[model samples]
Target: MTTPPFAPVTDADLAVLSEQLGRPVRGVVGVAARCVCGNPTVVATSPRLPDGSPFPTFYYLTHPAATAAMSVLEADHVMRELSDELASDEEVAAQYARAHEAYLRDRAGFGDVEEIAGISAGGMPTRVKCLHALAGHALAAGPGVNPIGDRALAMSTWSPERCACAQPGGAG
Candidate 1:
């Protein structure tokens, strides 16, 4: 049987990647940044959900096709191929910064609200509850209040109350 390629990311590396992405480094996520041939790459430590659990951290080369693809096995292979190219901490940080900036720039034009709603619906109960809560909020806010409008604003502000899912440990 072929062994699967998998590796743990150091906390230091995760911090470096978080800095590059301009976000708080919450868990064990890291990116390879650049391959030996100077191609861009990305690595993410796939942490569990808000509830503690185990899952695979993913790593991948930054090819055009890999952007929309999510596969654990493929991510492992790409990480292995680029592992040899990892050199200095500074090099890795720089590469991560560049790749992250490119990613952010590329996502600048996407505006799919339905996609956001789908992601928010974690399961049947969550979906039903979220939709009901949204309906209540819409009703309370009145007919002129658009749920999508509220969602857009909540997204910009990161308000948990206005979010689709109930706040952790709070009422749905």
Candidate 2:
């Protein structure tokens, strides 16, 4: 499997993550992808955290604008629509299943934490629980991998090709 490798997360990157998440980040292994503005879009986290938390979300989205856009979609009940589509579309379902498998391989690359083994974020393969997680995976893996993620990205106002990241203190 040719899963994408993570970029080295610098202290500055950590700072941006802290700001984006509004909390201190821990167990960040590497960066999965970045926004066009040179800010972290997806981060590859450890399966096991410092506090013994089994964090299954290996790919984390951190760009404020992208996150905000995902939130808008979720708030608009786009997940329910996507979930219905998953039930109705066999082709999309198969593609999503592949995405689930890909997620497992990438996390296993870190190390197997039995708790999260075979489990990927965003209710993948079965449902569309969270657009943020799907979007993060899409950004990390690139296009044509996660169908739901690609759909979400297409539906959202955010664009990977655009540098719409928010500056520190929520500036443009």
Candidate 3:
């Protein structure tokens, strides 16, 4: 048996996630990572929804600041630069491949989905498409797992080293 790489979700987590997303959170299996203040920074989700839909995103970034930073980077066209880096740099490309494997391993706990087999979100291994997905994988697996995610985090104004959360009832 393999140990899972995430923390279990709690009722408090569900509440905070609802606030972070401005909607109710669902299908979360675990708290993949946390803010320094213990907010749900990333969540591990089910591959198949209760409604029988296939959701490929296993590691989901939930913190508003992190998502906002990724949004800013995307608006700046960073994906193109990262994709070019993947094409030009062998070491980076290799690291991304490892990240893809890590993603698959992490997602395997939710069982398998045929439609998304061998497919991890954010264009892993050969491309850099979505910073949200890459950053989710990075935060969940920590810094060195995804090169693109690490780069994106470093490039962004938000830093995971701190707690930038506004918890429910102002506990933050």
Instruction: Give Cα-based local distance difference scores for all models.
Output: 0.30, 0.89, 0.88
* Consecutive 10-residue window with the lowest summed lDDT within model 1: 120-129
Error of 2 at 9 (Å): 0.9
For candidate 2, give the lDDT of residue 52.
91
**Whole-model alpha-carbon lDDT for candidate 3:** 0.88
Give per-residue CA lDDT, model 3, range 45-130, as digits (tens).
Answer: 89887887888899899898899999999999999999999999999999999999888877877888998899998998788889
Candidates in order, TM-scores: namely: 0.24, 0.94, 0.94
Model 2 residue 23 lDDT?
95
Which runs of model 1 end up more than 4 angstroms from their true locations?
1-3, 29-40, 50-172
lDDT of 2 by residue, 22-91 (tens): 9999999998998776788899999999999899999888888888999999999999999999999999
Q: What is the number of backbone collisions in each predicted candidate, taken in the order shown?
A: 3, 0, 0
User: Candidate 2 at residue 55, lDDT?
Assistant: 95
Candidates sorted on lDDT, descending: 2, 3, 1
Error of 3 at 40 (Å): 0.3
